[model samples]
Target chain A: MASMIVTDPSSAAAAVHRLPFARFSNGLISLGRFVGPLHVCSPTTTLPRTLSLRSPRSSRFITASMATEPSAKVIDGKAVAKQIREEIGADVSKLKEAIGVVPGLAVILVGDRKDSATYVRNKKKACESVGINSFEVHLPDDAPEEEVLKFISDFNADPTVHGILVQLPLPSHMNEQNILNAVTIEKDVDGFHPLNIGRLAMRGREPLFVPCTPKGCIELLHRYGVDIKGKRAVVIGRSNIVGMPAALLLQREDATVTIVHSRTKNPEEITRQADIIISAVGQPNMVRGNWIKPGAVIIDVGINPVEDASSPRGYRLVGDVCYEEACEIAAAVTPVPGGVGPMTIAMLLSNTLSSAKRAYNIK
Target chain B: MASMIVTDPSSAAAAVHRLPFARFSNGLISLGRFVGPLHVCSPTTTLPRTLSLRSPRSSRFITASMATEPSAKVIDGKAVAKQIREEIGADVSKLKEAIGVVPGLAVILVGDRKDSATYVRNKKKACESVGINSFEVHLPDDAPEEEVLKFISDFNADPTVHGILVQLPLPSHMNEQNILNAVTIEKDVDGFHPLNIGRLAMRGREPLFVPCTPKGCIELLHRYGVDIKGKRAVVIGRSNIVGMPAALLLQREDATVTIVHSRTKNPEEITRQADIIISAVGQPNMVRGNWIKPGAVIIDVGINPVEDASSPRGYRLVGDVCYEEACEIAAAVTPVPGGVGPMTIAMLLSNTLSSAKRAYNIK
Candidate 1:
């Protein structure tokens, strides 16, 4: 009878340790009788509002092996991104078929940094993939600021272009804010437009496009079933491009988001306590295994080029984390070349598709 | 040797328990030795730039008691605000003296909400106190939207006006965004303008003025030696006025900021882990002592009125936290009326001063 008192394993251990065997058994049986039937029906869950699988389909940009022996579970970014892109592509098709217009994405690339050129190319490819018309306006390295403004004015007046993305790290002399601000907010699909960033930061108002990379990072977490609620998240590097906005995005997700920068004292100690670590510092191997907590989810956004004599290019793409060590300690990890990079372009397409739908008033 | 391990009783027990006892003791002694000798010739301790006092000076509108208590530390809004006003007043004087120009603050107060009127009156008084000429345009409750726009346009073109504030809760019928955005970014002292908000949210860029109340809350924390780096901060409420902006400002301060709104589940459990809690839910006594971590700093921005027959007004101002319980458990807590409310006006004056300085080209 006492042995019957023990119910759950932990409680049973406590009951057995504190009470006589007959008393414990009796308690267990009573507890089991009271709770056993409850498991047959259901655990409470908040039902989805629409029961619609209408989220943007992920687009798989590049396939990288995610399975490892035993240490960490791979968070498959390419697969997730591909699925999102497919969903967005489907929506883009729906909008085009329903309405007479298709979403057009305009890219304004100033100067020719190889990296910037690559991004623009990727964006164009993504646009084509998502059924969005791609428009490119490449200004020379020394184009007049007035010319850029004129282009923006043209796009602002064009009803066909739903989104405009000005490649970042503009020529050193150009006033980036003035140039970015020139884009009509409706077409500022990069979400760099002040109105949109303001809306993203404001409560009750959602941005039409939460900047692609930050959006991608959050999407990765959501698809992976990471519980952001009440979890400590540490974002390293406070670059305008990634870290600061990413922190804001994480805060909206209900994770306590700490942004550690170069000025931060003992960032390692702070980072070690985080359930989630997003490093955008672009410093190779800056986040060591010792800096991470066991079972922490690591998202390395740094795409640093490290010297690799074996490679013909003399450098290979590496991440902020020492990948080998991180894998051993982390519960989940994202690979660099295939992780956040591809997802950003996918999100760009998703945003463009949404912009198209909103412009045409197509559901 | 064992006696050498002298632990300071004031150190948080949690911190002491985490590190080895000997290392903690050795570190303490080393810190003491390092600090003691530096002050022998020069008694003044040099605070780091991060710790520099950016607190606003007191305004002429209201002043609270200057009492220090053990349970709660005064936020000293008056002192901080006074410093800010002095700087602004000086700038205003320079503007007038140099270019036959004076900084003008235009306030648009719509409707006769008693609270709104009081706030407007206080803001006008603040404007005058800082040597800025105050121009007020009051619209009747039933005034047409075009009238408000007309007033905004007038202020926008007025070369004399350096800053503008449109008191909120405009009649339900008016388009708030269109009216607010009418103010030129240079004169948007309240910093609610979309462009200003966008600038605030971006990295490597700053808004001309941050929204006053949130800026004040963050200034209090910065002045009080509470380090935001890597700390868990919970912001209650999600209103554009206070909570959302406060979370953004805190994120800028590098704290792990979590936002809890009406939709959040188990807010108490979330708030309990906060190293710093900013409650602006406008619900009297919504947060109890159990919701706060022991020794956590609290900034209560709520100014709700609860029935109190004992008071002459038949109601008493109560904050989001039950002050009685909060004072006992929290390291520091701001009182309902005297804390954030005064700081807001002070920051407004600070922004006004900044505008005047920029307008007049005064250093």
Candidate 2:
């Protein structure tokens, strides 16, 4: 897959100029929506344009020549996530000072999987960083499913615990849906409940909590100032946690979204038509350079493990996208490790804090 | 809206041959699917084609000479609905004989809008026609919201009540969401339950009951043998009950779907891209002939009251579509009165029967 790759900025720009791609973009992303028309010009002729809508009075536009290098700008997810944490920390402190209460998140981990444990640890650290209290309950893989449900019920009744998240991929012996449904919807920080997802999909309705990973993906796009409304977006893979919800969030932002999976025919053709591409399929380097449209923005949500002899671990992590090739074609792209992963925990903290605020009747 | 209309069979055929309209059509209309590639000859030289996929043994392709006249086919929803009810009646009898079980539907009506009463009456009559038992609780305009809730609680506990539907637009005093939420999700025959809709949007997740009207629209297409896979379908409007769910269903069936709503710009251009169009907006005659592509299959769900004092009723029904114009331009179209309306009730009965079957652990 790596050897068959190629990338060219011109073809991608031409793809963006096509009908539907140009006509469909509503350009109303959450934070950094563009104002006026999207000027389509030769790459060198047009200055890099970024118009941000942080607020009515704070809106800013910047136009600068990018003559130094042709490579795309790296979207810094870590910095954006840190910025969000600062905002959340401020909110958390205000709530604590006014109400004499601190937001608390309870995590239930049922298995001994290394990666799941690592995720739980990271979430705990993130909560502490943002001034939210954290609680943990660990059980062995052989623990009865009822044991997990028991913990959830107790936490639901505990007013101190504003949010409860049962880490996923429970033992194959357990029913995933039943356990997920057991977490009371109000305390469901993971946002895996079907009701929350339903609200997210509908207009004029609000979900109690947006699933963290998809929320993080959208936050990254907003942070980097990508205009989404009416733009053609292709979401690769359709996992419940990331791809599916990500597509729904994009659609809510008014982007014309397509979910391409294994069954979809001419996946590359459809994907190339997108102005924004979000690849969450867990396949390593599955998206080659030619498959991308130049001037497109990419958010890579996939993190896969591949062999690397030089590393002491003998294996290194890579995203679903071929990062090296994507950077050449895309105008903006998120790197694998520092991109969506950090934002997920940040979103979880945000959800937990919001749940606490709601519980205390505080804004 | 009616005077400028023109429908040419030749032009419609030529339009069908242009791109995806022909390729996307599964052509499985109740009659037959096309046997070979559609020949784009002049309408005068060849006969009208009606390909249907009613059954493997019943498949037929007619290349007859349509030399008589040029007009679009009127899809009769009333007749199709009657056919569905007959099938449900047979299944209901079989369930009774085999398990001594009969399907029951419970309807809760608050307040007395004349239109709401008419709809409830029509539903009761339809229930009787299909051998399904109907239960109704009508509350006066001044009834406390709790009275409605009390009735829903009773119906939720009643084992015999296999399905529950609460008539919409309750009195201004009643909290609509609170009352609707009281209906046990298991008996939510209207499929308005958030969980049901959430499941519908997720891949590999099946909704317990698809909302009735949208379900009926899909059934009409299937009964008529419209091939949806790979087709470009546009659903006009984004109401939760009709247009939104319709778009989700179309996407589930492998069609590339676009939802055009009030906020949408250049909606006409997007609508023309569809080989199949389902318009649920109640705006009478909003969809004009030129807004449509030639030879498209249409399912019109709007039932607006239009003044037509020629006879006794003083007013009559119309669809979002300009019926006279659509009949001329479209290859096949559903008329306002006899099209999508009947199918909605039929679907309700179907859902109730399925619920009873599922409850009784019968296929």
Candidate 3:
């Protein structure tokens, strides 16, 4: 189970402004975006006395609390993504009017995996929504590896294309490293190139582009006014795409970072000491309430699907952290379905815009 | 006070098989190497019960202990580096006999900085000691940047040169990044290239060459039989050359690694949790006895020079850890002058040999 956010473009549009709310069996209403004065925590409860009001811009709070069980502030990635798209759209328009150039993104999809195809389609739609040009190539499963390289080569020479993305999970016969390396560093919007990662790891150096998922994770933290410097941050998982880069990013922000992987012993003990935790291990409910500090914030990148007999699809999406348990313990948390998923594509658009600006020598 | 071990070639040859020993005023004889103990420890002292017998091959132990203050086993890096050099020398002879190829390393020294010249001379000497061919090119302080690039290009084309190292702290007029990046990744034995670093940071990917100092730190752990897997490791400082790479290397060995930097708050609290600690920050004696966890293995990479009125040179070398304090607390500790210093040049020789083997396609 990989905790990556690859969502359909249509679903992203539909999920906007939807509040994350939970109703308990004890007749208690837990509103994720509730605001205004109301009954705070009961004095007799063992819950932490200090309530963390994270969203200063939104100014939301819990309306009522019948039970002592506390609720975490929802990160609301979908809403945040909506605002970012709007910002990008306005910038795209201004660039077009001033420089008479539209940012262009080129994507190459090798195989016909349903999820991969959906991601490509969503990416193209996202480009269109932000007034950016999108170029795509669909190759048959049996297509030769050279064919994919040819497309990348052509895109590399194309001045109009600012960003290039190769949809992953290439055919087994294809060498992913060779294909990925073929894309020029300037147009590597996906940022999987080792050069970008190397630059990111070193101090006094800047990567041309940060990986989209991790960038979105940091964006959420920045938007929520979370202080990263001098904080203890624990990142679960050591995956090349997400966890490793996320840890590096946190370290760059001056957060003393530790990564917990499968080989880590007593992970909960180390994780509970963190002021902020980023769980990208994809294991559903692996991070329990006890694994988090009382006021710690959680950004759950996992969107794992567990079997659900009552749901129409026979499965329901869950995050690495137990959402119910996290609400009662953490200061804030990102939901599995509507959280990091939408932000991934939004960051892709932003990267494309930035690349175009650099190409045209525009700020 | 950077802990980088830059020594003169003549001095490297002079300092061999030197044992680390400490004389205490408590009438305690602390011998770094004492095979067959006279007395273990007094039963009244508050110390860890389990004694760490690290050197199985050497079968060395503490010779005498008068007071309750227990002494740590010295890592004996000078002896370890000598062993490694002997192994590398034998391998170089075998490869030459088998394939009729001798490994070669090229050193480019810019400017007249005394320290930089000493490091280059040491590297050349070390290469010769290991039966590898050495090439040297010295440029004046005011040499043009193009001259350096020309030398790099020539070496890049030279089949005899398997590894190319450009001495760092190039003149202020030259761009370090551009000059470092000029050397092809294939011959980047110094391993400062972003591509090499990118590979080192990612999982399932291997860098052509690991940086010398950090590689030596890990080699010390492996030689001493210090367990790394499933252990908690802390790395002080985050410099690209040492601290950062050291943390990544520890992570690769399956140790949960945390990096503490200058901006980190309450560094002692985190450092005390590590089973193994590698201090690379140049600050002299910054990590005191209380900062180390009892029974932890310490690898000190800092070789800082502090003022010493009594010394002939008016200075003395110390490490990031307070040596006297660490000896009483840590299970084992590497000494400043003889610890990681000698190992760096040995690893450089090893990298050059490996590069030659790869180039010739020899097993």
Candidate 4:
């Protein structure tokens, strides 16, 4: 029974071989909707006397005609980000005109990794583009943890620095939690502070700043007019930076959110239930067409590198979802490289702008 | 099709008439398995072409004979809490012998609510039973917020006071968030602090303390040897105190957790999918027999006063789950009044003891 449903035959075969039989069976049952015929494939066999009831409207299943035409509205994060930056720039000018103050973002990069350096440079460029001040402190990889803490403390007290972001993947010798905790909650634009997250989780409490990536995902959803309230949302992965917070954000907007992590027994089954799916597991092309509910919104956060002989670079960036397959089945899909990737920095700028507004008591 | 399934025909009729059509239909489709006939009731009609598959093992559905005998193992929270208190007493004596220190809990009561006073008295009695020290400060309802903050500050600085609890529902004039935040994170035995909650939500981080009711729910699961890993668990509430934390705890334990709140369109469907259920919505008998998946574990945190002329007090406490219905369907169930009620203070004492241990650097 588990072997029948396959939107992409090769991927389904691969997945079956990759996952354990129990997990594969559970996942396949949920994928049964992708099969041409809507059979009553009850996944609740383990439970006593439970019947799997299919609604009379099972004709919405993806047919051959629906698969041929790519119809998903692409969520252009790059365009939305540009629009956001312009908005921020306008807000920055207004603030400066009103109170002679410009929002400032502080970046502390401890390591010399090429990727880290590129990210820092991009962030600084983003700040400049948005008419905000950018402050950078590049310390050696082996710099003492105390030095980093001192810089954070200085930034904490600096009135001009509205937001402080510490580039992640600091040297292994440094205590990450200790250093992250040093930034005062007010200046925690990166929103990695436990207090910020705590406030975000609680009802009737507002977080000063939400983490950039998840915040960016929600922003895209809003910009694209995706309904969140009372909808079912599934977040893949449980990383502190992305998956966990994304679920929290979706929940805040009144979604019935379920988080599927590495330990989840049937990720596909759970994910198939979501009206909105946010995949940030860093596993390229893990979410196949069969794993998606037809017309479900997809926010693919993964930016993994896959081999691409045709590209100038040896590898090409791909998201956690199969982009090509998703376009045919989903109502909307965020593309790789240009999707959630660009919106992250935009949210960081937005957070900084809001922080400055908060400091100056601006409406 | 939505009206066929009913464990108790009268209650089902009441539910159908009370709820709106859409919500009732969605809830009833999920409740289909409770009917004598194991018909496939598909809840996915809104979705395009998704088949509702039932496993071949549909014979486990509830039948008349099976419903007569109550077989669920009662999670004796009263007995378990007593055991916990005894264990804490042993630990308190050990800590006192080794460090010449007894754990002390300071509770601040601002109002003259009778229930609040009874709770405080019960807590004090529990602390005494566990060989710990308890300190109480009662303030008038008209007292300034600053006065309460002063007592909290003193408790925070006191070496002997390992735990500080401010009784909730402080005078309406006083800010609850400000007062709750005043208790230092180290001495936040109630675990109501945002930092503690934040730590609890994040992966690879340990909260100094977990909120008592939710912690008690998980402890009951552990004592009864319930397998949480990779299981489907549903938490039926989103309150900051119990429901939210309970879901987080279940997720931490590797359960694929889904939270069904007031806005959830299909609560019964989601609840039926759970291997374990923790309901803290405070709605008496909200979860009926049809909501239970055969052999699922039920932890009902709600203790609501339902009118009962048969009882001397004119009312009897009932849990969110219908107890008789749950016992017939669930493999394990927690009874109201005797269930989670007794475990809250036990967890409070446990937290205070652990706080003292951490303060003294005792293993």
Write down the RMSD of all candidates, one decimal each.
Answer: 18.7, 11.1, 9.0, 11.3
Mark the regions of model 4 whose C-alpha exceeds 4 Å error after superposition: A1-68, B1-68
**Model 4 per-residue lDDT tens digits across residues A1-363:** 122211111111112122221222233322222112112222211111111112112313232224345667688888888988999999999999999999999999986776567777878999999899999999999999999999999999999999988876689999987987888899888787788889889887888889888998998888776779898999987777787888999999989999987778778888889999998765557787777777788999866555556867545666768887777667778898798877888888999999999999997
* iRMSD of prediction 3: 0.6
Model 1 chain A lDDT-worst window of ten: A7-16
- Highest lDDT scorer: 3
Q: Select the stronger candidate by DockQ from 1 and 3.
A: 3
Which candidate number has the best TM-score? Answer: 3
What is the Cα-based lDDT of residue A132 in candidate 1? 84
- Estimate every model's Cα lDDT from 0 to 1: 0.67, 0.70, 0.77, 0.75
lDDT of 2 by residue, B56-123 (tens): 12334322223334466677888888888999999999999998998999887877676567667777
Please provide TM-scores, in order, for all candidate models, with all chains considered together.
0.72, 0.79, 0.86, 0.83
Error of 3 at A346 (Å): 0.6
Q: How would you encode candidate 2's per-residue C-alpha lDDT over A17-41 as one tens digit per residue?
A: 1111111112211111112211211
lDDT of 4 by residue, B183-277 (tens): 99999988878888899999788999998878988988887767799899999878887888889999999899999987788889889999999
Q: How do the residues A1-363 of candidate 3 rate in per-residue lDDT, one tens digit apiece? A: 111233331222112112123222223332332122112222222256344444635645433332365767788899889889999999999999997999999989987778778778778998999899999999999999999999999999999999998876688999988998899999998777888999999988889988888888888988887789888999987777778898999999999999988778878899999988988765556677777887788999866566566867655677767787778777788987788878888988998899999998888
**Which residue window of length 10 is worst by lDDT in model 4 chain B?**
B5-14
| Candidate maximizing DockQ | 3
